[model samples]
Target chain A: MTAVQIIDDLVARPGEGKALLDAYMADYAPGARARGMVLDRVLVSPPLWMDDQPNTLTIVWNVEGAAGWWGMRLAAGADPSATAFWETAGARLVSRARRFAAAPEDVETLCNG
Target chain B: MAKFTALITLQPGADRDAFARNIGDATLAQPTLPGVFDGGDLILHRQVANEAVPSDAAIAHIDSAVYEPIGGGAHEPGLRNGVYRCLLLAVKPGTPEATVRQFESETLAMPHYIGTIRNWRLSRVTKASGARVWTHVWEQEYADIGGLLGPYMTNPYHWARVDRWFDPECPEWIVDTRLCHSFCAFERSVLNP
Candidate 1:
């Protein structure tokens, strides 16, 4: 099965979400090109019914491998400017990056049928 | 055969119109991608807001390239050959950090929200003008439409429990209504074979 990583967050601002997303896209652009990880789709939407939290932004990227993802993270953190950008933004980044060893078919099936 | 779906939420002050246009352009520009079969945006109705519900501005995109090759054979008529659903939501302000944290935890705990999902991450952004917003993404595969609503659309008791878990202040006033603007489109491959 394909290995996947999921990055989730609770955003604090509107424009800031766009800015961070742009930075993330840029950070992965080089690696995506180099690794041949196809750009599936970038879906941008607003928060609907999010508990009591106000400004919330959600972004999801579908990629092919873990190496490219780790490489991208390393690149993002290595840059002092990027680190500063995240620090000053007052944004909390919560990420869940995991790799699936088996294909979807080989793993446990919940309700696929 | 099961289909894949993605739900994306936009940050505050993001231009919905421009965002839709960009996605449209991207899909038109690249068509050979196997992950995306057919997709689009969802347009919401304003009247629902007057009903005291939290209306969402959203877009729905469908991808039909799953299972078999595009144009390979006839798919189930009226079933969108291999379409996948994508929903976009417009978030509001005044969302507390605690509330956000709670929401994340609750979503993760959902039965259908586990394993199949990939890249379920969130981030906060600050603009040059000092504005801030929070965003996250949920991608998963479903056997049917019920899978999407399985975790969210259920008994009121469950929802009440989730609300209490997320919001301590004014928990009773927290409603679950959302409005969305949606659309549908196909993915195109830029590089010709």
Candidate 2:
């Protein structure tokens, strides 16, 4: 049971930061939930945070662990809703920079219902 | 007004019954965001489904969306009664952005029940998952179904411009419409009015 933190730092069209969240909530979130991934939190950097980009939305998803994350991705391959989620998310993301890190032992579980 | 939309899905190694309980607690505990329809929350497999939506997917995710009345649309000080007509689009692959944009703009401008409320939510499919095909969703609510069947449906602007775009050759896009009766439960007015 490998626990890894999946963070996606995404950039969307100007003022389309909301679209990124909407796509996740409406399209991506459920699909990930199906595979045991909770896109539980979000952080948006100030427009001036980046020199070139204006709108950057950072979405955080805590999988049960690395095994769980990979398992979900595998399950999503044949799932129609999962497929649709990617299609929907792809159009909204201008760029997505992702990283995986180890989670702190003293983390809180907000929602994994 | 009772207006909440749910999407349900099933997945591997997921508990159907226990997950329900988690969603119940999660939904109750989830904080409300600052928005028009922010009272409702989501129920995920074992937690709150992200920060929004109470629906169930055919695959593994269940979420929801609760619509609130617009300015003065609330019959009283709170929510109101209205007929909800929601359209979830399943667009064909490679549909031109211009075509989609045009369709959205045209449909949005169509005639509708005056004083009635409408939410033309237009979006694109950007991610992949168990439940696919749904690209965008458009919401409309009126005092009666006639609003959709009458002006919204019959308006020449809708038929001539918007309808034409939903061509028979490319019919997979926006293939279904769900009509629900809004009501009130647990003290909050909902969408299907």
Candidate 3:
């Protein structure tokens, strides 16, 4: 199976970064796991918290392949809990986005398969 | 079906009906307009089965289109006085064909997640005459203004997922930000019209 990576890049509102991260952990992460994604990593850019400026939370997740990706989407779409988390996330976030990507070695298999 | 849609900004004190006649039997709407909609005064929709939709000559700032439904033009004849909304957008020039298809698929997926859309149509613009050459028209009906502006807008499937294509901040964005988001109250199903 080809492995796929999904990234959620979120920039929190000034002074609210840590709280946003806490919310994602409490509110979003469990639902994400239920949707067939495996939490891969959570990275904080600049590796420090500051009250005056925004902090970026980069969340990475993994699923098997296209099927796994679509499965996650279908499940997430049907889940109101997932919707609620994102709706509330806006208040804490300055900007956010989710991107799909693959590793260099898996690119060919992903494209062909 | 052949369809024609127009987003018209009326000249000061222009009579709505007289100006609407230029577009030919359109279901005209004047719902609460939004900022992105560029202060449009009317949302005009007209459709005919297997016939050419005529042109318009309204002396107002208008963004109009002749299109054929590409997806989801289900009929709901009994629905009345519902809010009808239309979004006219162009995929940026030079976006990959595959990405454009993905955008279309994601857009069509909205009905699956949001139940508030009572009737909907996604169309490909065959002839565009407007402030910009719009590529697609997405039309929908909601039971009330609350459904159009509330759950429809607040739903995660809308803001988090499908919106990625429209949000400039997202790398997945392909559609230009200058979109035509106009809606108005309708007496009957415009999709049926």
List RMSD in Å for every model shown: 22.2, 21.7, 13.1
What would the TM-score be for candidate 2 when compared with the true structure? 0.34
TM-score winner = 3
Q: Model 2's lDDT to the true fold?
A: 0.45
lDDT of 2 by residue, A52-96 (tens): 454788877776543464455446545677546556666656776
Between candidates 2 and 3, name the one with more favorable lDDT.
3
Please give, for residues B24-140, the per-residue lDDT of candidate 2 as tens digits.
533122211222121122222111123343344523443344333221223323333434444444555687877666666655554232233443333333332223345554554
* Residue-by-residue lDDT tens digits, candidate 1, B1-193: 1111222234445555555444431222111212321222221111111111123454222211111111111112222212222322213456676765565556445433332221122212121110112133222223343433443233222232343332212122222223221222223211110
Give the C-alpha miss distance for residue B176 in model 3, angstroms.
0.8
B88, model 3: CA deviation in Å? 0.7
What is the C-alpha DockQ of each candidate? 0.02, 0.01, 0.07
The 10-residue segment of model 2 chain B with minimum total lDDT is: B178-187
Judged by DockQ relative to the true structure, which candidate is superior, 1 or 3? 3
TM-score of each: 0.26, 0.34, 0.61
Let me know the DockQ for model 3: 0.07
